[model samples]
Target: MNLQTKIPLKPNTYNQIDYHSKVLLLGSCFSENIGEKFEYFKFQKLQNPFGILFHPLAIESLITNAINEKEYTKDDIFFHNEQWHCYDSHSKFSNASEIELLQNLNNQIRSTHQFLKEASNVIITLGTAWAYRFIETDEFVANCHKIPQKRFSKELLSVEQITESLEAIMSLVKSINPKVAFIFTVSPVRHIKDGFVDNTQSKSHLIAAIHQVIEPRNHNYYFPSYEIMMDELRDYRFYKEDMLHPNAIAVNYIWERFVQVWISEETKTTMKSVDEIQKGLSHRPFNSQSDAHQTFVKQLEEKKHLLQSNLPHIIF
Candidate 1:
């Protein structure tokens, strides 16, 4: 669990599995990306009714709120096209009745908790400790601007508070489903707005809290997503346009590193073949909009020829 040692660390990332795995992803938006990658890798994804966020409190709030009601919909919980549910194309918040919306939210939470109970391995990608909280209730919210920033103020969680919250979450998870194993990871994406020193301190505190909580326990463990990105892939070139989330190439690198830890050698070979094909095609030059389709065709033709020799069979 400790980044230094304890959880038999992988050199790059965890290994890819030959057969699809039934995984439930919790934690931040990074978990959503991981889930997307797992699907891309052909792993069977278990649906989570709750949306992913940087904090568990947000997830818990959604679920708790939903459970108290009866109706449900994906829009009641998930983020779509970078916009939160109510904030998306439809401002359902303004149109939907409170009783109906309340019920939908409750059902979403109940479904999510049920999903967590059945998940074989729960991957939790914690984003940051800094969050905006509602001033009246002292409850932390996901996006403060949804209700106006004046309603909520920013709060920085102490190391002890984070530890306590995580411990409580662990208890909840175990209480509902004793068989599931938890895999913790600190998201490497920087929170440039959290103040450089404070953000750094927050991450350091999280890493320490994770190790302290899980090291003594045999079943719970952590994966070094933060270390892999921060230490191994230090170059800023790996980042995307936002410079917050890792670029596609960087994500591939991180996923590869994760595969090294969990996937078998045979599975690794298959993944490598697939990845090579993708990398080879993604680099083709397209000078203008007109060239895009033609370039794609050329890439496909090149791929076809490349595959003709020493062909790699995808059994699954």
Candidate 2:
């Protein structure tokens, strides 16, 4: 008897990702997990250049700003907890020097602009519909930068608002790169801090908004990452000790499913070669000067050279 319920999944008949595909992944920490898989398989990809943006409006702002090449100034950032922080970006961009912070932000803008123009597949993972509005500025902030609660008001985006935000993202991206494909997925990491019921509502809104824009005939698609986590891997065992994010095993399961549906068959063979090279490169020998170890290192270098010869964009 079948013990598990699986979502019906099939390989994409067109626009499948290969080694040559320049994939740009945005939004949420879960997007990093999938990005790691792409890095492991030596695929051409850029992940979260503005850091992990959790909501569609933040992503929409990023797309619009990047396309317009918005330069960050001192006014765009604030000093918080003795560090400079930008409300439009994750705290990872925070720095002790305000000048450095603004420079980094503007640099990312130019780089994101370039990568986005060349990207073939843009995979966006939405984490939550809940957002924080900085009351003083009357604008939604992507991150609160650990500021006190009273400084910002919390709000949940309606499905219609999210749909409009997503549409704006698509439209802006298409204006620059008409052939780019979009794969939208709701992140499986439950936002428990928002309360259990609120988390469900937030995810529901994100998924509903995604469906409103995804059309296979237009090269816009949705991947059921959240559903697979909720149903197929429906157990506390699949989550980390925090009991929220998917554990590595669960991420691997979801990744394998993604590969089956989106990765090209020819790319799978290249991935195997890349995986073997990766494993070999990471191998540590007990004896550093041994002839056997030296031979192994040489052989590994040769393997890297061969792979790089074909895929010059890849580097170990």
Candidate 3:
């Protein structure tokens, strides 16, 4: 008997990711998790240039700004708690110097714009439908940045709103890169702070909206990450101690599933080679001067050089 119900994932027959594929991942902390995998595997990827954007509208705003080459001005940012922060970006982009912050934001936009034009796959992981609208600016902020809660009004984006935002994202990105495939997934991280029931409602909205917009025939795909977490690995064992985010095991399991769907079969052997090199680099030799250790190091170096010769973009 099957121990667990698995989400049926089909192998991607076309547009499979390879070492040469340029991937851009945006939205959610989960995007960062998957981006870390891509980084470890040394795939050509750029992830969350503006930082972790959770909602569809926030991601839509980011793409719009990037595609239009929006310039961040003083009015777009505010000095709060002794640091400069943009309402549209995560706190990671906030800086002590206003000029520095603006420079970083604009530079990221320029770089993301250029990358989007050449990206083979654009993966977006929407975290929530809930967003905070700064009442003062009448704008939805990607992150509250620990400002007083009273200053902002919380709102839940309806399915129609999210669908529109998704459509806008696709339209804007496709205008520049017509052939880029879009893969959208709902982040599995539970927002328990929103209250358990409210969190479910928020995820429901995101799921509904994503289904409304995704067209597989158009190369727009939806990966069942949330479903896999809730169904296949439906236990607290898959969660971190906080019981909100997926632990390393769950992340790895989801990643393995993702690889089966998106990564090309021909790249698997290369990935194994890269994995061996990565493991070797991390291995700490108890006897640094021993002949055995020295021989292991030499073998590792040879493997690295061989891999790099074919995929020069991969760097240890």
lDDT of 3 by residue, 1-316 (tens): 9899888888988889999999999999999999999999999999999999999989999999999999999989899899999988899999999999999999999999999999999999999999999998798989999999999999999999999999999999999999999999999999988999999999999999999988978989999999999999999999999988999999999999999999988898889998999899999989999999999999999998898998898999
Better of 1 and 3 by TM-score: 3
- Once all C-alphas are superposed, what RMSD does model 1 give against the true structure? 7.8
* Candidate 1, superposed: residue stretches over 4 Å from native: 1-8, 11-20, 59-107, 266-316
The best candidate by lDDT is: 3
Model 1 lDDT, residue 249, Cα: 85
Instruction: Mark the 10 consecutive residues where model 3 has the least summed lDDT.
Output: 6-15
For residue 45, give model 2's deviation from the true position in Å.
1.2
The Cα local distance difference test for each model comes to 0.63, 0.93, 0.94
Question: Using Cα atoms with residue i matched to residue i, what is each candidate's TM-score against the true structure?
Answer: 0.69, 0.98, 0.98
Model 2: runs farther than 4 Å from truth? Answer: none
- Model 2 C-alpha lDDT per residue in residues 231-296, reported as the tens digit of each score: 999999999999999999999999999999999888998999999998998888999899999999
lDDT string for model 1 (1-316, tens) is 5332223455423322344445667666667767777766545454334454675455445434433433455543434344444311113332235455445445556666666666666677778888777787776766543565787787777778778767766666667677666778998888888888988987887787787677424457778888878777777788888877888887887776777676677666655666666565566455535667677767767755664444433212
User: Predictions ranked by TM-score, top down?
Assistant: 3, 2, 1
